[model samples]
Target: MAPIQFQVGEKYFTANTKTLTEGSAWFKSLFSGSDKLVLKEDGTIFIDRDGDLFAIVLRYLRSQKVPVFYNKIYGHNHLLYDQLLTEARFYQISYLVYYLENRFYAGYVASVKVEILGLDHGVDVPLPDRDDDTDVQYYPQWCRKEVYVCPRRVAVHRGNPGGCGRECRAAQGDRPLEYEDEWVLKTTEIRTQTILKHNMDSVKP
Candidate 1:
């Protein structure tokens, strides 16, 4: 296979499509003779990633393992770590992504210093855990349809004979982070608390 030139993160990189296709479903589908993706003037692809992360990806493709260079970098930089995770997921390199996320989440848990108040009652100090399936059956949804369309508007009666239920849409939600689903994947088995994560680096000192 010819090397496909790509401009990721506005940097140019030449990569073998065959190696990429083997690792990523996204790559296989994109380059599988489908004309949906447009090529560059130089007959290459233009992906929206910066050339930086792809460099690590290329190294992984060559070695078939997470790059050694990634360890210390994620240890010191949270922002870049998140960025690398996004790139890894986009490329569908589950092995690389799994390790990166485990590293990041481990760092996050070790550094978690926030004080959480007991929100056993339905108050906002710590927010209630809305994930319980019972909440959807007992409460009225606090919704303003004019703002946006939410799927919670519909209700289904599940696991009860002659029982009816309505959806509950509370404004304050405690859903997992964007990468949390990846973390919760049974194959990845990323052990973590259900609380949302935050980075101190994001706050101005």
Candidate 2:
């Protein structure tokens, strides 16, 4: 059988009608009848959509697998996944849309709390010269004011919950210089409390 030729934007693509129809309901409906299609003079169907994204969509139709967005050299390209989601929605590919949404966008809200605890001494106070206290000095006691507490909201992706702690620490900023001293007895605690906002599985296609 002759392959179906498509012109998406400035690019051209060809695929077997069986693959397109099986992968997408939109394509199945589009080619439902023998006389339904209105091909251009060049014998190719024209689709007013992104050509580059259509290539990815076509690849998925052939392979029936999600495209790899991450590599050792460039890491994960989240923007590419987002673009694929858009293209999948446009093509009415339910499985691709479901996979993309659950793998990346589906996540819970987390409340991150970072606390710094230790004793911190303030500047020494000098006592006034008196008959019996001329050489005396006064030092204020360590107080709770020295403790640091930072609260933040981090979106925890279902694929990488461990990354939430790293994001929380970064958002809390650097620790105090005094805490860096070996002699200073300080403790840093990072806590993450997860809150489920909604279930992505229950979302309708």
Q: Compared with the true structure, what per-residue lDDT tens digits does model 1 show for residues 1-205?
A: 6787777767887888888887766778888876657677877677777688888777677656443322321334567767878987888777667767776344333332223222212333332344411121122233221222233422242222223223322421464211111111111111212222332231111
Residue 181, candidate 2: C-alpha displacement in angstroms: 36
Off by over 4 Å in 2: 33-38, 104-205
Q: Compared with the true structure, what per-residue lDDT tens digits does model 2 show for residues 1-205?
A: 6887789888999899999989798788888874546678888788888999899899879877566564323445789889888988878898888878886433332222233333234333333334311122233342232322332443343223344466556765675312111223223222222233333332334
**Best candidate (score: lDDT):** 2
lDDT against the true structure, each candidate: 0.52, 0.60
In candidate 1, stretches whose alpha carbon ends up further than 4 angstroms from where it belongs are 68-75, 104-205
Clashes of 1: 4
TM-scores, one per candidate: 0.44, 0.47
Worst 10 residues of 1 by lDDT: 179-188
